[model samples]
Target: MSHAHDLVPFFEFHLYGKEQIPDLSNLPEPRLFSTHFLFHSLPDSIAKSKCKIIYICRNPFDSCVSVVFHQCNCTIIITQIILEEALERYSEGINEFGPFWTNILGYWRESIETPNKVLFLKYGDLTGDVTFYLKRVAEFLNCPFNSEEEGNGVIENIIELCSFKKMKELDVNKTGKMVGKYENKVFFRKGVAGDWVNHFNPWMVEKLSSVIEERWVWSIFLISLSNTYISIMA
Candidate 1:
Protein backbone atom coordinates (compact mmCIF):
# COMPACT_ATOMS: atom_id res chain seq x y z
CA MET A 1 0.00 0.00 0.00
CA SER A 2 1.25 3.52 -0.81
CA HIS A 3 0.37 6.99 -2.04
CA ALA A 4 -1.11 7.26 -5.52
CA HIS A 5 1.90 9.30 -6.65
CA ASP A 6 4.22 6.84 -4.92
CA LEU A 7 2.70 3.97 -6.95
CA VAL A 8 4.92 4.18 -10.04
CA PRO A 9 8.03 4.02 -7.86
CA PHE A 10 6.95 0.85 -6.11
CA PHE A 11 6.00 -1.57 -8.82
CA GLU A 12 3.78 -4.53 -7.83
CA PHE A 13 2.49 -2.39 -4.93
CA HIS A 14 -1.21 -1.75 -4.30
CA LEU A 15 -2.61 1.69 -3.59
CA TYR A 16 -5.71 2.60 -1.56
CA GLY A 17 -7.34 5.48 0.22
CA LYS A 18 -7.92 5.66 3.98
CA GLU A 19 -11.68 5.24 3.74
CA GLN A 20 -11.31 2.38 1.29
CA ILE A 21 -9.06 0.40 3.62
CA PRO A 22 -10.51 -2.74 5.21
CA ASP A 23 -12.65 -2.10 8.31
CA LEU A 24 -10.17 -3.93 10.55
CA SER A 25 -12.83 -4.06 13.26
CA ASN A 26 -13.53 -7.73 12.61
CA LEU A 27 -10.12 -8.58 11.24
CA PRO A 28 -7.22 -10.33 12.95
CA GLU A 29 -4.52 -7.94 14.19
CA PRO A 30 -1.70 -6.55 12.07
CA ARG A 31 -2.67 -4.29 9.20
CA LEU A 32 -0.93 -2.03 6.69
CA PHE A 33 -2.04 0.90 4.58
CA SER A 34 -0.07 3.66 2.87
CA THR A 35 -1.85 7.00 2.64
CA HIS A 36 -1.40 10.61 1.55
CA PHE A 37 -3.83 12.09 4.08
CA LEU A 38 -2.10 14.28 6.66
CA PHE A 39 -2.26 13.93 10.44
CA HIS A 40 -5.39 16.02 10.94
CA SER A 41 -7.13 14.40 8.00
CA LEU A 42 -7.08 10.82 9.31
CA PRO A 43 -10.29 9.24 10.55
CA ASP A 44 -10.98 9.35 14.28
CA SER A 45 -10.87 5.56 14.60
CA ILE A 46 -7.48 5.31 12.91
CA ALA A 47 -6.15 8.34 14.75
CA LYS A 48 -7.10 6.96 18.15
CA SER A 49 -6.30 3.35 17.29
CA LYS A 50 -2.90 1.72 17.43
CA CYS A 51 -1.41 2.07 13.98
CA LYS A 52 2.02 3.11 12.72
CA ILE A 53 2.50 5.90 10.21
CA ILE A 54 5.75 6.09 8.28
CA TYR A 55 5.95 9.77 7.42
CA ILE A 56 8.42 10.15 4.56
CA CYS A 57 9.36 13.71 3.71
CA ARG A 58 11.72 15.39 1.28
CA ASN A 59 13.08 18.92 1.02
CA PRO A 60 10.21 21.29 0.24
CA PHE A 61 11.98 22.83 -2.76
CA ASP A 62 12.67 19.47 -4.33
CA SER A 63 9.19 18.22 -3.49
CA CYS A 64 7.63 21.30 -5.07
CA VAL A 65 9.73 20.94 -8.22
CA SER A 66 9.07 17.21 -8.47
CA VAL A 67 5.35 17.77 -8.02
CA VAL A 68 5.38 20.34 -10.79
CA PHE A 69 7.33 18.08 -13.12
CA HIS A 70 5.10 15.12 -12.29
CA GLN A 71 1.96 17.17 -12.78
CA CYS A 72 3.10 18.78 -16.03
CA ASN A 73 3.94 15.47 -17.71
CA CYS A 74 0.70 13.87 -16.63
CA THR A 75 -2.28 15.14 -18.65
CA ILE A 76 -1.94 18.81 -17.63
CA ILE A 77 -3.47 17.99 -14.26
CA ILE A 78 -1.64 20.76 -12.37
CA THR A 79 -1.20 23.54 -14.91
CA GLN A 80 1.43 25.53 -13.09
CA ILE A 81 4.77 26.52 -14.56
CA ILE A 82 7.32 26.39 -11.78
CA LEU A 83 10.05 28.09 -13.80
CA GLU A 84 8.46 31.54 -14.09
CA GLU A 85 4.69 31.96 -13.70
CA ALA A 86 4.20 29.52 -10.82
CA LEU A 87 7.32 30.76 -9.13
CA GLU A 88 5.87 34.26 -9.19
CA ARG A 89 2.61 32.97 -7.76
CA TYR A 90 4.46 30.90 -5.15
CA SER A 91 6.37 34.01 -4.03
CA GLU A 92 3.06 35.74 -3.43
CA GLY A 93 1.69 32.62 -1.65
CA ILE A 94 -0.99 32.08 -4.29
CA ASN A 95 -1.29 28.37 -5.02
CA GLU A 96 -3.95 25.80 -5.80
CA PHE A 97 -4.21 24.80 -2.12
CA GLY A 98 -2.57 27.36 0.11
CA PRO A 99 1.23 27.05 0.51
CA PHE A 100 3.49 23.97 0.64
CA TRP A 101 4.73 25.08 4.06
CA THR A 102 1.41 24.25 5.67
CA ASN A 103 1.39 20.76 4.22
CA ILE A 104 4.89 19.97 5.54
CA LEU A 105 4.29 21.42 9.00
CA GLY A 106 1.28 19.14 9.46
CA TYR A 107 3.44 16.01 9.32
CA TRP A 108 6.46 17.56 11.03
CA ARG A 109 4.42 18.45 14.12
CA GLU A 110 2.83 15.00 14.20
CA SER A 111 6.19 13.27 14.17
CA ILE A 112 7.44 15.41 17.03
CA GLU A 113 4.47 14.72 19.28
CA THR A 114 3.48 11.16 18.57
CA PRO A 115 6.95 9.72 18.16
CA ASN A 116 5.63 6.18 18.62
CA LYS A 117 2.76 6.44 16.15
CA VAL A 118 4.76 8.32 13.51
CA LEU A 119 8.28 7.77 12.20
CA PHE A 120 9.91 10.64 10.37
CA LEU A 121 12.00 9.86 7.30
CA LYS A 122 13.99 12.13 5.01
CA TYR A 123 14.29 11.28 1.31
CA GLY A 124 17.94 12.38 1.32
CA ASP A 125 18.69 10.04 4.20
CA LEU A 126 16.67 7.28 2.56
CA THR A 127 18.79 7.44 -0.58
CA GLY A 128 22.12 8.11 1.13
CA ASP A 129 21.73 5.42 3.80
CA VAL A 130 19.10 3.11 2.43
CA THR A 131 20.02 0.10 4.52
CA PHE A 132 20.05 1.98 7.85
CA TYR A 133 16.66 3.58 7.27
CA LEU A 134 15.27 0.38 5.76
CA LYS A 135 16.23 -1.47 8.91
CA ARG A 136 14.64 1.21 11.03
CA VAL A 137 11.45 1.06 8.94
CA ALA A 138 11.41 -2.74 8.97
CA GLU A 139 11.73 -2.68 12.75
CA PHE A 140 8.88 -0.16 13.03
CA LEU A 141 6.78 -2.34 10.74
CA ASN A 142 7.64 -5.41 12.82
CA CYS A 143 9.13 -7.11 9.76
CA PRO A 144 12.71 -7.42 11.01
CA PHE A 145 15.17 -8.29 8.25
CA ASN A 146 17.20 -11.42 8.86
CA SER A 147 20.72 -10.17 8.30
CA GLU A 148 22.28 -13.62 8.84
CA GLU A 149 20.29 -15.49 6.22
CA GLU A 150 20.16 -12.73 3.63
CA GLY A 151 23.61 -11.25 4.34
CA ASN A 152 22.43 -7.64 3.86
CA GLY A 153 21.44 -8.49 0.28
CA VAL A 154 17.75 -8.40 1.26
CA ILE A 155 17.88 -4.68 1.93
CA GLU A 156 19.71 -4.06 -1.33
CA ASN A 157 17.11 -6.16 -3.15
CA ILE A 158 14.25 -4.12 -1.76
CA ILE A 159 15.96 -0.83 -2.56
CA GLU A 160 17.01 -1.98 -6.03
CA LEU A 161 13.51 -3.19 -6.80
CA CYS A 162 12.25 0.29 -5.86
CA SER A 163 15.06 2.18 -7.58
CA PHE A 164 14.10 4.89 -10.04
CA LYS A 165 15.71 3.31 -13.11
CA LYS A 166 14.38 -0.14 -12.37
CA MET A 167 10.82 0.98 -11.55
CA LYS A 168 10.68 3.27 -14.61
CA GLU A 169 11.62 0.36 -16.85
CA LEU A 170 9.08 -2.10 -15.41
CA ASP A 171 5.90 -2.79 -17.39
CA VAL A 172 3.71 -2.35 -14.33
CA ASN A 173 5.07 1.16 -13.83
CA LYS A 174 5.73 2.32 -17.38
CA THR A 175 2.60 0.86 -19.00
CA GLY A 176 -0.13 0.50 -16.38
CA LYS A 177 -2.44 3.45 -15.75
CA MET A 178 -2.03 4.75 -12.21
CA VAL A 179 -4.93 6.23 -10.20
CA GLY A 180 -6.66 6.72 -13.58
CA LYS A 181 -5.06 10.14 -14.12
CA TYR A 182 -1.27 10.45 -14.08
CA GLU A 183 0.50 9.45 -17.33
CA ASN A 184 3.80 10.04 -19.10
CA LYS A 185 5.40 10.45 -15.68
CA VAL A 186 6.94 7.38 -14.10
CA PHE A 187 7.06 6.87 -10.30
CA PHE A 188 10.82 7.12 -10.29
CA ARG A 189 12.19 10.26 -11.94
CA LYS A 190 15.73 11.18 -10.88
CA GLY A 191 15.43 9.96 -7.27
CA VAL A 192 18.55 11.82 -6.20
CA ALA A 193 18.29 14.27 -3.28
CA GLY A 194 19.53 17.89 -2.98
CA ASP A 195 18.59 18.53 -6.60
CA TRP A 196 16.94 21.71 -5.30
CA VAL A 197 20.39 23.33 -5.14
CA ASN A 198 20.44 23.33 -8.93
CA HIS A 199 17.12 25.17 -9.11
CA PHE A 200 16.72 27.49 -6.11
CA ASN A 201 18.89 30.52 -5.58
CA PRO A 202 20.08 31.58 -2.11
CA TRP A 203 17.58 34.43 -2.08
CA MET A 204 14.77 32.07 -3.06
CA VAL A 205 15.71 29.67 -0.30
CA GLU A 206 15.78 32.37 2.37
CA LYS A 207 12.52 33.87 1.10
CA LEU A 208 10.79 30.50 1.14
CA SER A 209 11.99 29.81 4.67
CA SER A 210 10.72 33.20 5.84
CA VAL A 211 7.33 32.50 4.27
CA ILE A 212 7.15 29.12 5.98
CA GLU A 213 8.08 30.58 9.36
CA GLU A 214 5.41 33.24 9.01
CA ARG A 215 2.56 31.31 7.39
CA TRP A 216 2.64 28.17 9.50
CA VAL A 217 2.29 29.58 12.99
CA TRP A 218 -0.50 27.14 13.74
CA SER A 219 1.95 24.25 13.48
CA ILE A 220 4.39 25.97 15.82
CA PHE A 221 1.60 26.63 18.33
CA LEU A 222 0.38 23.06 18.10
CA ILE A 223 3.83 21.72 18.90
CA SER A 224 4.10 23.92 22.02
CA LEU A 225 0.48 23.44 23.11
CA SER A 226 -0.57 22.11 26.48
CA ASN A 227 0.06 18.57 27.63
CA THR A 228 -3.63 18.42 28.53
CA TYR A 229 -4.52 18.31 24.85
CA ILE A 230 -2.02 15.58 24.16
CA SER A 231 -3.21 13.52 27.12
CA ILE A 232 -6.89 14.03 26.42
CA MET A 233 -6.99 14.12 22.63
CA ALA A 234 -4.16 11.87 21.49
Candidate 2:
Protein backbone atom coordinates (compact mmCIF):
# COMPACT_ATOMS: atom_id res chain seq x y z
CA MET A 1 0.00 0.00 0.00
CA SER A 2 3.00 2.25 0.17
CA HIS A 3 3.11 4.88 -2.57
CA ALA A 4 6.09 5.56 -4.83
CA HIS A 5 7.38 8.34 -2.62
CA ASP A 6 7.61 6.31 0.56
CA LEU A 7 7.78 2.71 -0.61
CA VAL A 8 11.45 1.91 -0.04
CA PRO A 9 11.56 3.03 3.58
CA PHE A 10 8.25 1.41 4.36
CA PHE A 11 9.14 -1.99 2.87
CA GLU A 12 12.93 -1.73 3.51
CA PHE A 13 13.69 -2.53 -0.15
CA HIS A 14 14.78 -0.26 -2.91
CA LEU A 15 11.74 0.80 -4.97
CA TYR A 16 12.14 0.01 -8.65
CA GLY A 17 9.03 -0.48 -10.72
CA LYS A 18 5.59 0.98 -10.63
CA GLU A 19 4.26 -2.00 -12.54
CA GLN A 20 7.44 -2.18 -14.64
CA ILE A 21 9.45 -5.38 -15.11
CA PRO A 22 10.96 -6.83 -11.90
CA ASP A 23 14.66 -7.69 -12.17
CA LEU A 24 15.20 -10.20 -9.40
CA SER A 25 18.48 -11.75 -10.51
CA ASN A 26 21.07 -12.65 -7.88
CA LEU A 27 18.67 -11.74 -5.11
CA PRO A 28 18.75 -13.92 -2.01
CA GLU A 29 16.56 -16.94 -1.77
CA PRO A 30 13.38 -16.44 0.27
CA ARG A 31 13.65 -12.91 -1.08
CA LEU A 32 10.56 -10.76 -0.66
CA PHE A 33 9.19 -8.78 -3.60
CA SER A 34 6.59 -6.09 -4.12
CA THR A 35 4.81 -4.68 -7.14
CA HIS A 36 1.73 -2.71 -8.11
CA PHE A 37 1.02 -4.42 -11.41
CA LEU A 38 -2.49 -5.64 -11.92
CA PHE A 39 -2.86 -9.34 -12.54
CA HIS A 40 -3.20 -9.16 -16.33
CA SER A 41 -0.09 -7.02 -16.59
CA LEU A 42 2.15 -9.06 -14.29
CA PRO A 43 5.35 -10.40 -15.78
CA ASP A 44 4.94 -13.63 -17.72
CA SER A 45 7.62 -15.36 -15.67
CA ILE A 46 5.94 -14.54 -12.37
CA ALA A 47 2.52 -15.49 -13.62
CA LYS A 48 3.83 -18.82 -14.87
CA SER A 49 6.11 -19.50 -11.91
CA LYS A 50 5.32 -22.03 -9.22
CA CYS A 51 5.91 -19.39 -6.59
CA LYS A 52 3.08 -18.21 -4.37
CA ILE A 53 1.59 -14.74 -4.83
CA ILE A 54 -0.24 -12.88 -2.11
CA TYR A 55 -2.42 -9.90 -3.06
CA ILE A 56 -3.75 -7.60 -0.39
CA CYS A 57 -6.61 -5.19 -1.07
CA ARG A 58 -8.13 -2.41 0.93
CA ASN A 59 -11.66 -1.03 1.21
CA PRO A 60 -12.19 1.69 -1.39
CA PHE A 61 -13.39 4.28 1.09
CA ASP A 62 -10.32 4.03 3.26
CA SER A 63 -8.13 3.94 0.17
CA CYS A 64 -9.51 7.29 -0.92
CA VAL A 65 -8.82 8.88 2.44
CA SER A 66 -5.33 7.40 2.58
CA VAL A 67 -4.44 8.78 -0.86
CA VAL A 68 -5.75 12.18 0.09
CA PHE A 69 -3.66 12.33 3.21
CA HIS A 70 -0.53 11.08 1.51
CA GLN A 71 -0.81 13.57 -1.34
CA CYS A 72 -1.55 16.49 0.94
CA ASN A 73 1.33 15.69 3.23
CA CYS A 74 3.93 14.59 0.71
CA THR A 75 3.59 16.60 -2.47
CA ILE A 76 3.22 20.36 -2.76
CA ILE A 77 1.77 20.20 -6.29
CA ILE A 78 -0.83 17.60 -5.39
CA THR A 79 -1.74 19.44 -2.21
CA GLN A 80 -3.63 22.12 -4.13
CA ILE A 81 -6.43 19.84 -5.27
CA ILE A 82 -9.36 19.49 -2.89
CA LEU A 83 -10.62 16.12 -1.72
CA GLU A 84 -13.59 16.29 -4.10
CA GLU A 85 -11.32 16.78 -7.12
CA ALA A 86 -9.07 13.97 -5.98
CA LEU A 87 -12.00 11.61 -5.55
CA GLU A 88 -13.10 12.28 -9.13
CA ARG A 89 -9.62 11.54 -10.46
CA TYR A 90 -9.61 8.43 -8.30
CA SER A 91 -12.87 7.20 -9.78
CA GLU A 92 -11.48 7.78 -13.26
CA GLY A 93 -8.36 5.75 -12.43
CA ILE A 94 -6.31 8.89 -13.02
CA ASN A 95 -4.67 8.86 -9.61
CA GLU A 96 -1.40 7.24 -8.68
CA PHE A 97 -1.31 3.93 -10.55
CA GLY A 98 -4.95 3.79 -9.64
CA PRO A 99 -8.19 2.97 -11.17
CA PHE A 100 -8.20 0.85 -8.02
CA TRP A 101 -10.95 -1.55 -8.98
CA THR A 102 -9.26 -2.34 -12.30
CA ASN A 103 -5.97 -3.14 -10.59
CA ILE A 104 -7.84 -5.83 -8.66
CA LEU A 105 -9.76 -7.78 -11.33
CA GLY A 106 -6.96 -9.93 -12.77
CA TYR A 107 -5.58 -11.04 -9.42
CA TRP A 108 -9.05 -11.47 -8.01
CA ARG A 109 -10.08 -13.87 -10.76
CA GLU A 110 -6.75 -15.68 -10.62
CA SER A 111 -7.21 -16.20 -6.90
CA ILE A 112 -10.49 -17.94 -7.64
CA GLU A 113 -9.25 -20.07 -10.55
CA THR A 114 -5.98 -21.08 -8.89
CA PRO A 115 -6.75 -20.78 -5.21
CA ASN A 116 -3.60 -22.56 -4.16
CA LYS A 117 -1.20 -20.33 -6.06
CA VAL A 118 -2.74 -16.90 -5.56
CA LEU A 119 -3.67 -15.99 -1.99
CA PHE A 120 -5.94 -12.98 -1.77
CA LEU A 121 -6.05 -11.03 1.50
CA LYS A 122 -7.94 -8.04 2.76
CA TYR A 123 -6.28 -5.42 4.92
CA GLY A 124 -9.34 -5.40 7.13
CA ASP A 125 -9.32 -9.16 7.71
CA LEU A 126 -5.54 -9.27 8.20
CA THR A 127 -5.55 -6.54 10.84
CA GLY A 128 -8.72 -7.96 12.36
CA ASP A 129 -7.24 -11.44 12.78
CA VAL A 130 -3.53 -11.22 12.17
CA THR A 131 -2.68 -14.41 14.01
CA PHE A 132 -5.11 -16.51 12.02
CA TYR A 133 -3.94 -15.14 8.66
CA LEU A 134 -0.33 -15.34 9.78
CA LYS A 135 -0.74 -19.07 10.32
CA ARG A 136 -2.62 -19.39 7.05
CA VAL A 137 0.14 -17.58 5.16
CA ALA A 138 2.82 -19.67 6.84
CA GLU A 139 1.03 -22.83 5.87
CA PHE A 140 0.68 -21.67 2.30
CA LEU A 141 4.40 -20.97 2.15
CA ASN A 142 4.98 -24.63 3.23
CA CYS A 143 6.63 -23.61 6.44
CA PRO A 144 3.89 -24.03 8.96
CA PHE A 145 5.18 -24.16 12.48
CA ASN A 146 5.31 -27.52 14.19
CA SER A 147 3.51 -27.99 17.48
CA GLU A 148 6.73 -27.43 19.34
CA GLU A 149 7.22 -24.09 17.65
CA GLU A 150 3.65 -23.06 18.40
CA GLY A 151 4.07 -24.03 22.01
CA ASN A 152 7.26 -21.99 22.05
CA GLY A 153 5.39 -18.88 20.80
CA VAL A 154 7.38 -18.59 17.60
CA ILE A 155 4.40 -17.26 15.65
CA GLU A 156 3.65 -14.75 18.34
CA ASN A 157 7.25 -13.58 18.24
CA ILE A 158 7.04 -13.13 14.48
CA ILE A 159 3.77 -11.24 14.75
CA GLU A 160 5.15 -9.01 17.44
CA LEU A 161 8.21 -8.29 15.38
CA CYS A 162 6.15 -7.08 12.42
CA SER A 163 3.31 -5.42 14.27
CA PHE A 164 2.42 -1.88 13.17
CA LYS A 165 3.13 -0.52 16.62
CA LYS A 166 6.65 -1.97 16.61
CA MET A 167 7.35 -0.93 13.02
CA LYS A 168 6.12 2.59 13.64
CA GLU A 169 8.46 2.90 16.58
CA LEU A 170 11.56 1.76 14.73
CA ASP A 171 14.33 4.30 14.18
CA VAL A 172 14.36 3.72 10.43
CA ASN A 173 10.67 4.44 10.10
CA LYS A 174 10.90 7.51 12.27
CA THR A 175 14.08 9.09 10.94
CA GLY A 176 14.60 7.73 7.44
CA LYS A 177 13.76 9.56 4.25
CA MET A 178 12.64 7.32 1.35
CA VAL A 179 15.17 8.87 -1.09
CA GLY A 180 12.06 10.07 -2.88
CA LYS A 181 9.86 13.03 -2.12
CA TYR A 182 8.18 11.89 1.08
CA GLU A 183 9.37 10.86 4.53
CA ASN A 184 9.15 7.19 5.51
CA LYS A 185 7.01 8.03 8.51
CA VAL A 186 3.96 8.91 6.40
CA PHE A 187 3.39 5.32 5.32
CA PHE A 188 2.52 4.37 8.90
CA ARG A 189 -0.45 6.71 9.15
CA LYS A 190 -3.51 5.65 11.19
CA GLY A 191 -3.23 1.91 10.55
CA VAL A 192 -6.85 1.16 11.36
CA ALA A 193 -9.93 -0.21 9.61
CA GLY A 194 -12.53 2.53 9.94
CA ASP A 195 -10.42 5.62 9.32
CA TRP A 196 -12.62 6.44 6.31
CA VAL A 197 -15.47 7.21 8.67
CA ASN A 198 -13.59 10.24 9.87
CA HIS A 199 -13.31 11.78 6.38
CA PHE A 200 -16.15 10.42 4.28
CA ASN A 201 -19.57 12.04 4.63
CA PRO A 202 -22.82 10.15 4.11
CA TRP A 203 -23.07 11.06 0.44
CA MET A 204 -19.46 10.16 -0.17
CA VAL A 205 -19.97 6.76 1.41
CA GLU A 206 -23.04 6.01 -0.72
CA LYS A 207 -21.27 7.18 -3.86
CA LEU A 208 -18.19 5.13 -3.29
CA SER A 209 -20.27 2.13 -2.32
CA SER A 210 -22.21 2.28 -5.53
CA VAL A 211 -19.06 2.60 -7.61
CA ILE A 212 -17.34 -0.30 -5.86
CA GLU A 213 -20.37 -2.51 -6.23
CA GLU A 214 -20.70 -1.69 -9.91
CA ARG A 215 -17.07 -2.38 -10.74
CA TRP A 216 -16.15 -5.18 -8.33
CA VAL A 217 -19.21 -7.42 -7.99
CA TRP A 218 -17.71 -10.22 -10.09
CA SER A 219 -15.41 -11.72 -7.46
CA ILE A 220 -16.60 -13.47 -4.31
CA PHE A 221 -13.96 -11.53 -2.38
CA LEU A 222 -15.34 -8.14 -3.43
CA ILE A 223 -18.94 -9.28 -3.03
CA SER A 224 -18.20 -10.27 0.55
CA LEU A 225 -16.40 -6.98 1.07
CA SER A 226 -19.37 -5.00 -0.27
CA ASN A 227 -21.69 -6.89 2.05
CA THR A 228 -19.41 -6.25 4.99
CA TYR A 229 -19.36 -2.56 4.23
CA ILE A 230 -23.14 -2.45 4.07
CA SER A 231 -23.65 -4.40 7.27
CA ILE A 232 -21.16 -2.28 9.17
CA MET A 233 -22.51 1.02 7.89
CA ALA A 234 -26.14 -0.02 8.34
Candidate with top TM-score is 2
Per-model TM-score, in order, reads 0.73, 0.81
Per-candidate local distance difference test:
0.65, 0.75
Give residue 72's lDDT in candidate 1 (0 to 100).
Answer: 69
lDDT string, candidate 1, 16-130, tens digits: 3333644445534564456555567667777777788777888767876676667566445443235445555665656554556655677777777787877888888888887
Q: Any residue pairs clashing in model 2, and if so which?
A: 93-99
lDDT of model 2 at position 57: 86
lDDT (tens digit, per residue) of candidate 2 on 44-80:
7779889899999888888888888787765554333
Shift in Å, residue 215, candidate 1: 4.0
Candidate 1: list runs displaced more than 4 Å.
1-31, 74-82, 88-98, 150-152, 201-203, 216-218, 225-234
